[model samples]
Target: MENQWLQVSYADLLQATDGFSSANLIGVGSFGSVYKGILECFETVVAVKVLNLLQQGAFKSLAAEWEALRNIRHRNLVKILTVCSSINFNGNDFKALVFEYMPNGSLEKWLHPNVDEQPQLRNLNLTQRLNIAIDVASASSSSFENTNHDLKPGNVLLDDDMVAHVGDFGLARFLSEAAESCSQNQTSTFGIKGSIGYIPPEYGMGGKASKYGDVYSYGILLLKMITGKRPTNDMFKDNQSLHHFAKSAFPEQVMEIIDPRLLQENAEAFLDSENHNNLKNKMRDCLVALVRVGVSCSAESPGERMEMREIAMEMHAVRDLYLEVGIQ
Candidate 1:
């Protein structure tokens, strides 16, 4: 899509925004503030992502944003409808991106299960999780998915429809001749590059992100969904990570505690089988499948990866098992 500089004058934006009042603020991000805006053209509702001007190099974020979304196609990836600029402080000129509003906010907000959200929507179900995974998997394998480096969770977006769409391509690169392209999961002692809780230990080992890295992060997200926990320096202080803890227990019942909204029937299985040991075995197998995918993709030894296409196929198989046996 050709980039359309915003049609409304920057002056008009100031008037409509009441001098950029905090009330208009939607979310604060690494770049800048996001505001809900109504355009003069169609009176359309949109999300305006504004980056810090004082930070100066914000243009790279814009280029990265553009690189991430421009030509690629996927229902799971957010779509940028237009670009706009606002004059604020001399150093911090406002650079903004307008997107179709996502009523659900973000997976981060939902995964965290905060007070601001609807009590009824406390967590995402297996189908919802799998659907999102599938969406990301599809994007991870797309031509745009081919990045020199890895993808970050911050780049992923969920619309009001609950459809997951990945955005922000600036940091993404084609799987290098040897890498899986992403990983942020790291040990508490050492932080990873992107989001803290999401990085992999291998990343702490100075390894690059790969499909496996994404897998690892996905596993963490799964654990978060199942446990309703947050990442902290002492996250595992009780000697349990959402991963190890979930793996150590029975998912059939306790897993419901992870995401208050999950029905007992939904936690029964993921990759398949009611024939495993404790919830540990069942979950171990499921996560083993997941971690295997993540590890293989992130293997410093690149030859080990199953490639994005294979990764997507494998996830589909696991999802089929969930749908066939997991519906509550």
Candidate 2:
């Protein structure tokens, strides 16, 4: 059966976004520009990603995204509404993708809030963070069967309810049949596929993209969410990295490295003596477990990393524990 996707006309999108006006442009990336638009036929809000056909890599990315999105269906994954391929008024080749608009935007902006933004806008509490983590984990685990070569904060979008939806499959690729029979020493033909900070260590040595590499990238993302620090943070000098920094602070010193906003949000709950310090203890335990999972999944050796199945189960358990403790 042909893939179930709407083939929208270029004129409708032009009308929707007022000819892709600058005011409608919401995001710009290596592949294309994303504009906020409302499709009049359906009366629905959508994100229109118009690919830059002039860029050599954009064509491959467009194909990869279409192939991956058409084959996958999961609650935590981004939903594609339609696609457009045609010539523009200027007679230039145009290719675009329309997606369900995510009101809350990317996880990157929320985690590392803009300096000029209001303080109230920057906070993401422990419970919300845990929920987002679970959402991403579920998406990652589901996508492992047809691995996403790129997994990072920028790719994680939040809906109106703050539920995370993993998007951007431009670099995705399924493991080839030959890969299953090849020796471990053989390098991947797909080439290096992830953003700098999230790339797995083995990929540096010409390793192939595998479920393990996705896990490593997810690990880095998890650590970044918890600590409010990117893998490329300046503090990670003298052989230190986000992974090692988080690993070293495990169990005892977790709070020291944890996002201050998270702590501040729950300060009153921690101060409640009637709970008999139960909330505090549960939070600490949850943090320790979460950090351990991050470290284990991002292990320097791909062979040492935990599988997504295990990571998913453990993360769900952690979220359950957090909810059970009633630490709001």
Candidate 3:
């Protein structure tokens, strides 16, 4: 169905989200909260992203998201349904964006699930992770890079079919050529404009938003997917980073740093396959190619990073070869 923005009332949202109860709160961000709710008008479950207008820059974030998403549509990008801008019962301004609810939740929870709450780690097999990387790359290659300055695992959501959709465009900037040319040294009044570790080196140095910066964040996310480690891990201190950590183990010792869960799955396949040696070699090659792309795209220098188009093409090739191996 074609997506369209509907006029929704604050009272409607209140009922749909059960008065925004703690139970309905699915996720919280720096400027807003997301709640899972049933939208009676659409006859479907939706995510309500309520903006905290009281917070500094919150209105601007909402405006940024609206400007970024209003004209975009892509299979790999999150679908925004409608927006509500009105007064709350408390005589205060209320703003919320309704989005298609994702059943599987964010890639963050899956990558680093809490064992206390989820006894079984939600393991994303090699094939699944590869596909997700491809999906995000596809989204990155789109106009969303006009710039989605925040491309992290937490902003990637999965649907019922496990298709990855990049969302949360609060940090997005729609730039023109003239503006972009002069943006190299421009600083954001909102500070760095991205999560730590995911922010590109150039951005921290007062560079303005750019597609290259998005590519850098995508690179970090891709590496995180393969390694099952956050870029901000305690181990990545004293000048160390996720990029260096992965690059240090590239090609040869990839197996050592890769997520053990992925290795365990491959081990099971090897035990059952008569061509186990060939299978092992192919998997190694696939992983090596992935790491190389991740490392190349996340170079410290923006000029050194891979283009989003090239990254998408490489990920698609990797996923195709992986599926051909009959591992999925």
**Ten residues in a row with the worst lDDT in model 2?**
172-181
Q: Looking at model 1, which ten-residue stretch has the lowest summed lDDT? A: 172-181
Models ranked on TM-score? 3, 2, 1
Give the Å shift of residue 283 in candidate 1. Answer: 10
Clashes of 3: 0
Candidate 3 backbone collisions, by pair: none
Estimate candidate 2's alpha-carbon lDDT, on a 0 to 1 scale: 0.81
The true-structure Cα RMSD of candidate 1 reads 6.5
**Model 1 TM-score?**
0.70
> What is the lDDT, from 0 to 100, of the residue 18 in candidate 2?
84
Total residue pair clashes for candidate 2: 0
Q: How well does candidate 2 match the true structure in TM-score terms?
A: 0.91
lDDT of 3 by residue, 1-328 (tens): 1344676799999999999999999999878899999978768899999998888667878888877777888998889888899999999999999899999999999999876756245889998898899899989897646665468998999999999998988754522221344444444323344476787776655566688888888999999999888998999999999999999998799988888888888788898999988888888889999999999999999899999999989998988888778877
TM-score of each: 0.70, 0.91, 0.92
What tens-digit string does per-residue lDDT give for candidate 1 at 74-130?
676777777766566554466667777777677666665558768565567656776
* Global lDDT scores for all candidate models: 0.57, 0.81, 0.83
